[model samples]
Structure formats: structure tokens, C-alpha cells
Target: MEFALAALFELFESLDQCAPGSRAATLQALQACEGLAPGARIVDFGCGPGPATVALAQAGYAVTAVDRHGPFIETVRRRAAAAGVGDRVTAIVGDMRAPDFADGAFDAVWSEGAAYSVGVPAALAAWRRLLAPAGWLVLSELCWREGARSAEAAAFWQREYPDMGDVTQLEARCAAAGYAVRGGFWLPADAWAAYYGPLEAAVPAVRARHPQAEAQAALDDIGREIALWRRFGGEFGYRFVVAQRG
Candidate 1:
């Protein structure tokens, strides 16, 4: 697990950047929860490398970052410590699908391009339970127009995620889970470029540095995904804003 994560971090040179505004956008969307005090509780649900986790910590929030991958969790922990927020952020190795977080323990829950990793319904239902009353949950997920299911879109999302749906459907899931529809939008693909462009730059450096490494293969795969991301799934790529636990 550690080796896999290490490779991921090494190979995906710009993964942090490719992750939708270095997750600053996600943080901004979730700031609605700021109605809480500065030292409020925040959960970076499925936090890959602690972007939002560290940001929350820096903002004086007590943060808990959870990821199923052992190496990823380790990386989050190390980064938190290195970034001077180790004491403020508690790193937990766990799954986001059905996270083991205690009920209503958080002021906000942040999930960027991860809820779909777990089925949206399950992710929606599960994350809701972790929020304190009035807690906000911010998610940037794959969304498409309701009218069309092109063979291309279907094929792409099926391979990537069989359960993904349009933004409206996702919003319904949130309502079913007791969350209010606070805000939602069709996120522009430019965000993907922000994350991918930096990564694209890093690829050459990695290839040059590790000419014979497996990172090359991972880089190729990421490159392929990025190049085709919008083509196959552009209609559905979206971001959502919600609050719940009422």
C-alpha cells in the first residue's frame, strides 16, 4: 500500500494541482459552514493528499482526514506534520464509501471528486451521518445533462464509475439523505485543465528522471484519462453544495 501510494505521488506529479484548484475551490464551496466558529470541526472525507485537510488546519479548524489507502493516509499525516498542522489534523485510514466516523461529529464534510468512488447514494447517506446539525457537505462530482446518455458518455462513465448520475439526480440523493440543496452548479472543465496542466508539465520531468520506472506507465494512464475526461464525460462533470444533519 505504501509503495503504491508512493508511486502514485511520484508519478502523478501534478495530481495535487489536477485535483480541482488544489482543492481551494472545494474549500470555498464549503465555506458556507463557516457560520461555525473558527475552531470548528471539518472532515476531509476521502482526502487523497490532504489539500483541504491542511487548508482547514491552517484556517484554525480541527480537521480529520480519512482515506482507505494506508499509504495515502500516511502521506496525509506526513504532509500535515510537515506543513505545521500535524497537531490540528488527525489522519485516519478508512474508506469513504461507508466511513467509520462517529455521527454528527463534524461541522463540515468535504469531498472533492471522491463520492463517486463510493456509490453516490451510499456516499450521500453515509457522509450525512457524520455531520453536526447544520453542517455543510461540499462535493465536486461527475455530472451530465439529464436528456442525453450518448454511447460515448455511457461507455466512459461505466468504465470509470457505473453509478454516476447527472447533478440533479445527485441533488435528489442529498435530499433523500436529509440535506438541503444549498448550492450546486455544472463545474467548468477549465478546473480540470488547472489540475491537469500542471500534471502534464510534471510528466516530462518524471519521465526524464525515472526513465525506467513504473511511474512512466502511471503517467501515461493519467495522461490518457485527462485527455479523454471531457470528451467522454463533459456533459456530467459538476460540483455541488449542500448542508444537512438537521
Candidate 2:
């Protein structure tokens, strides 16, 4: 498990993004978060490599970017500095599931394509206390799209994310977790391409470096994930949800 995790971390460490997202999509979600003026306090959970963190800081928010990985947190700090938003961004190596901030400390909580690390329901429930009254919670989660699903895709997600559900079910989860459903949108196919393109290009070099069985298994898992998206993408996608603390 340690060898596999090391291989996974090495493979993903240099990518500009750790997930399927774009600056455009991040800004779009920001726009959906009404009433937050410039310099609003925002906390980014599971902020791998700080793509969204820098974007939010660029948009004039004071952002606290949190991730468990030390290297990724350092990358966030470097990116924020390079982007000229270092003063506005605070990068920390910490668990998203149990951030150490005081209750009601933020105007918004942002996470892009990383909420699944802890189940979305648990995330929604746990993170709600960090938001100020009526503060926004924005996140993108992998979810089943409406209509037919291929057996292969179904099996893949069932094994990988057994708690996965449709958008409506997700919305219900938000409400159940004490948030008011604001709105959501589907991430485009190019979003996936953006994340996978560099990842696919980097795989061969990583495989060559880490020639152990566990490392190879990790690489194979990533390959299979990418291939599954190519074959059955329409059945599942990342849904960006904007909910306000109720």
C-alpha cells in the first residue's frame, strides 16, 4: 500500500491540476456564489496543487488552501506566489475532513473534484460548521448522469464509489446535511481531457521509474480509469454543486 501510494503521488505530483477542472469552471462556480464580495474569506478543502486556490485568490478572495500532502501544499504556496496572490493565499498541510479553523470562520468553502476523498455526505456535514451564516459551499463530485448506464461503467463506479448517486440524490444529501441547494452544472468533456492529457503523457516515465508490482498496479488502475471514461463517459460525470449553509 505504501509503495502504491508513493507511485500514485509521484505520478500526480507534477500535474497542473489534481482533478478534472478549469479556471473557467472555477470562476463559473464563484459567480454562482452570490453576495460574496471581494476579499471574502474562503477555505479550499483537498486543495491538491492549488489550481482552484490560486484562481480564487486571483478573483480577490482570501483563500486558505488545505491538503494532507506536504508537497502539494508547498506547490500551492509556490503557485500562489508566482500568481501574485501569495498574500491572499494561505497554504496548509492538513486534513480536509477535520480542518482546524474556528467554527463559522469562512464566507465560502470551495473544493474541486476532491470531495469524494471523504464521502460527500460526510464532507457536507462536517464542513458546514466552518461556514458563516448562509455561507456558500461549492464542490464538484463524480455522479451518475440521468438515463442508461453501461454495465462496465456501472460496475466500475460500484466498485470504486459505491455511494455514488445522481444529481437529485446529491442535492438531497446537501439538504439533509443542513445546506440549501443553490444550483449545479455538469462539467464538460474537455475538463476530463485537461486533467487526463498530462496524466497520460506522464505515465510511461513514472512506470519506468517505479518498476515494482504495487507501483505497476497503481499505474494500471489509473489507465483503466482513463480508459473507462473514454468508453463510458456519458454515463457518469463530475457535477459542480453550489449550496448555501442553511
Best-matching candidate per TM-score: 2
- Tell me the tens digit of each residue's lDDT in model 1 across 22-99: 445655665655486678888887788777788778878899988886666787788889989899999998878877
Query: Global lDDT for candidate 2?
Result: 0.93
TM-scores for all candidates: the values are 0.79, 0.98
True-vs-predicted CA distance for residue 84, candidate 1, Å? 2.9
Off by over 4 Å in 2: none
Clashing residue pairs in candidate 1, if any?
Answer: 17-195, 18-195, 143-236, 143-237, 144-235, 144-236
Model 1 residue 37 distance off true place after TM-score fit, in angstroms: 2.7
Worst 10 residues of 1 by lDDT: 12-21
User: For candidate 2, lDDT tens digit of each residue in 97-181?
Assistant: 8879999999999999888898887888889999999999999999999999999999988998898999999999999999998
Clashes of each: 6, 0
lDDT of 1 at 128: 81
TM-score of 1: 0.79
